[model samples]
Target: MDSIQQFLPIIAMFAVVYLFMIAPQMKKAKNEKKFAAELKRGDKVILKSGLHGKVAELYDKDNSCIIETMSGKLKYDRSAISMELSKSLNKPEAKS
Candidate 1:
């Protein structure tokens, strides 16, 4: 009983961490993956490096994409895209 009591606090701490931190992180990663996989040509996106461009082509086999920027077309890994920033960038403006 004493050993169980000592570990109770540690177990509760892990539960709290998983619920507050780990769960949200896993959800965000799943959403990001869905966003990356659903990417199609002509969709605007922002890279992790802050460079913005439109999807010019997709290479599913390589898990990469070609982005068309004002300067030129560049290739990047799908994981290099920023999901949150791209969602905000492509969000329709509200007229108010």
Candidate 2:
């Protein structure tokens, strides 16, 4: 009974940490993987550098894509794309 009292706080702390901190991160990673896998050419996305562009081409490698931003068609590693652009899908505003 006394051992339970001592270890209970540690177990509770780990559970709380995992629930609040680790679980969300894992969920986010899974979602990002799903999103990335679903990406296709002509998808508008924003990069980590805050440059917004449409996917000009998708390479065979993971997250490797050619983005057409203001500077024109630039090859960016897949991880460079921060997030996908959900709106403003018409003729591309920025040319390659």
Candidate 3:
């Protein structure tokens, strides 16, 4: 009973960490993966670097994509896309 009491705080701390930190990270990663997999050509997206472009092509074999920007088309890894910013950019504007 005494040993269990001593370890209780440590176990609780670990649980708190996992719930607050680890769980959200895992959820975000899963959502990001789903977003990446659902991407198709002609979808407008934003890169993590803040570059805005449309998906030109997807290379599933290499997990990369080509982005068509105003400058030119550039190839980048699919993971380089930013889910949050792209989603917000694609969201329809509301009228007052």
- Which candidate leads the pack in TM-score? 3
Candidate numbers, best lDDT first, in rank order: 3, 1, 2
Regions of model 2 farther than 4 Å from truth? 84-96
* TM-score of each model, paired residue for residue: 0.92, 0.81, 0.96
Query: Mind giving the per-residue lDDT tens digits that candidate 3 earns over 43-76?
Result: 9999999999999999999999999999999999
* Reference-based TM-score, model 2: 0.81
Candidate 3, residue 69: Cα displacement in angstroms equals 0.5
Q: Write the per-residue lDDT of candidate 1 for residues 1-96, one digit (tens) a residue.
A: 999999999999999999999999999999999999999999999999999999999999999999999999999999999999999999999999
Greater lDDT among 2 and 3 belongs to: 3
> What lDDT score is found at residue 34 in candidate 3?
100
**Which candidate comes out best when scored by lDDT?**
3
List pairs with backbone clashes in candidate 1.
Answer: none
Whole-model lDDT, candidate 1? 0.97
lDDT of 2 by residue, 1-96 (tens): 998999999999999999999999999888777767777998888877878888899987565889888878998887776644433443357877
Model 1, 2: alpha-carbon shift in Å? 3.8
